[model samples]
Target: MQHVRVYTDACLLFVEHKVSWDDARKSCRSFGGDLVMIKDSAKQKFILDSLIFEHWNTQNIWIGATDKAKEGDWRWIDGSQVTYGNFANGQGNNHNTRRFIFSDGSNEDCALIRRSDGGLWHDYPCAFGLGSLGYHYTYACEFTRSGYGTTIGPTNQTGSTDISNHTSSMAPITSTIETMAPSTANPNIETPAPTTAMPNVETPAPTTMANIETPAPTTLPNSETPAATMSNIIGKKRRL
Candidate 1:
């Protein structure tokens, strides 16, 4: 099968195909890509005019463009609607008799194209057993931008102190369009509070027991009874 590729600078996506319309679309979606949809006269004309050869079996290759998601609402696979469509005179008026057929066969509701002569579009039957232009069954494809290039900013920051202190730098920001200056005039700008010194504590003296008072002991009664007992004993001895 022959591989066909289509792209435009205005759209970020592109489509290429070498398989049936269904397979082509599946491949596109696998990579977050879609088949090319001719939305306007300009895009249609651009696609037709850019053709270099006519290897496509049908007039147009199936594009990611379709109204299948919402019948009759015709939208590209990317959710874009048909702002423009080039239907050869009286085309697209099939009275809804056919939904998926292209021009090559019956029952094919996909799109088809001729890469050699920049042919117009028509419905074809997708189930028809007819082989492609070269009997090839696979198409490898991808999308790309025209005249557009991507730029990457520096990822490392070992050079200048300005880069290290981006918040305080005066360099104009070029990555985005909107720019703003730091609020240097605001009087309410926050300032860190000062830290307080810790207090010095002195060790206390040891306690002593000498200052404690002791209670005095009470004295017993005098021995007057013992003296009288001794006199009585002496008198008894004298009597004995």
Candidate 2:
């Protein structure tokens, strides 16, 4: 195993170590970090320049980048998809293969880099058993910005100014939060019935008419004259 230290003042990231791919990853994780991913040419160069000339015998070191979660969907272990990588010429040809081999005979899927006499990037495979520079591995590796720095924040030292500026440049979100309130504060109100009252029934009076009778006159008075008397007698006979 071989170990080396690399630092960047601008990014405040420190990378150090050379261990087996597994051990290197474990070491980074033990410190609550992970192997570094070189996102740009500048960063790649910085790592390369930091290494000693002899260390460049290999092509590169295993990085904390892989697509093991989903085949062909290459991404870092932190769930970040790789937008930039430092693959050598005709490298990454074995797309479906699990192992990544550099120009050197070392077999590893991930690795870091340092420059050789020719000013070209070289790969250093992660070794498990050998011990060098406090790292029990032959290949040198680096830790990500979060892994190396004391404070785990954005790699940019401008205090996320880029993100803020981008937010200001873009249009604001149009969506608004809609708060719904009950139509009435009290839900117990009941509707009133119709105002018209029902009609009352009246009983008819009983019939009160009674039967009546008139007694016939018992007698008729006789007249003073004879004729009158005769008329009275006839009237009496008629009555009887």
* Candidate number with greatest TM-score: 1
Q: Which ten residues in a row have the lowest lDDT in candidate 1?
A: 164-173
Note the Cα lDDT for every prediction shown: 0.43, 0.44
TM-score of 1: 0.39
Per residue, candidate 1 scores C-alpha lDDT tens digits across 1-240 of: 222323333322223334566666676556444566666665555445333222223434555544444434555566876566544433332323433344222233444444433455544433235433332122223344432222212211112122111221111212223468777776885888876876777768886658766667667777565555788989999999
Error of 1 at 125 (Å): 4.9
Candidate 1 has an lDDT of 0.43
What is the lDDT, from 0 to 100, of the residue 125 in candidate 2?
32
- Against the hidden reference, what TM-scores do the models get? 0.39, 0.39
What tens digits encode model 2's per-residue C-alpha lDDT throughout 1-240?
Answer: 223233442221233343566686775566455666666666555555434322344543456665544544556667787677655543332333322232222233343442333333222333433221222333333444333434332221112212211211111122244579758666776889877977777878888778667788878787566545788889999999
Model 1 residue runs over 4 Å out of place are 1-17, 53-59, 93-108, 114-118, 125-240
Write down the TM-score for model 2.
0.39
Name the runs in model 2 displaced over 4 angstroms.
1-18, 53-59, 93-108, 111-240
